[model samples]
Target: WSEPRVWPLPNVWLGVSTENQKWADVRIPILLDTPAAVRFISAEPLLGPIDLWNVNGINAIEPDWIGGPTAGTGCPHP
Candidate 1:
């Protein structure tokens, strides 16, 4: 008989991405619907401004943390 092997899992249960507005707009909803312990989005090295004002997924999940280009990085949110 063969013995079964155990697989290791990651400590962080969050999903991470650096998607731009268009991609994020489409994919965020799907990620939100998925069963994850946490969800995260990173706008670092951001190409342009992202308007999340009307993204229902964000409103529903209300993520604990968000990261992106800050002051002096020349990338600002409008």
Candidate 2:
């Protein structure tokens, strides 16, 4: 048996949501390894700080877009 391979798909976008460095560190690498036309991070409700520039001591891999909820302009909160 052979390991599964991931291939880049047309018009496919992949993303992960991270509120802080912890989750970013955990999820970003996996997202980077996956094949996607575009990769992004959603920091909605940004509960804490995150540093995408340096994750897992690697100075590589960055999301195509990093977006978060703008003050009073995003999804309604309870």
Score every model by TM-score.
0.49, 0.59
**Which one is best on TM-score?**
2
Q: Clash pairs of candidate 2? A: none
* lDDT (Cα, tens digit) per residue for candidate 2, span 10-75: 567787877667887898888888767677777655556676545432323332233544443422
Backbone clash pairs in model 2 (N, Cα, C under 3 Å; residues 3+ apart or in different chains), count:
0
3-70 per-residue lDDT for model 1 (tens digits): 76332233445544443577667767786786554465655445555566665433222222335444
CA RMSD of all predictions: 7.0, 8.5
lDDT of each: 0.51, 0.61
Superposition error at 13 for model 1 (Å): 3.0
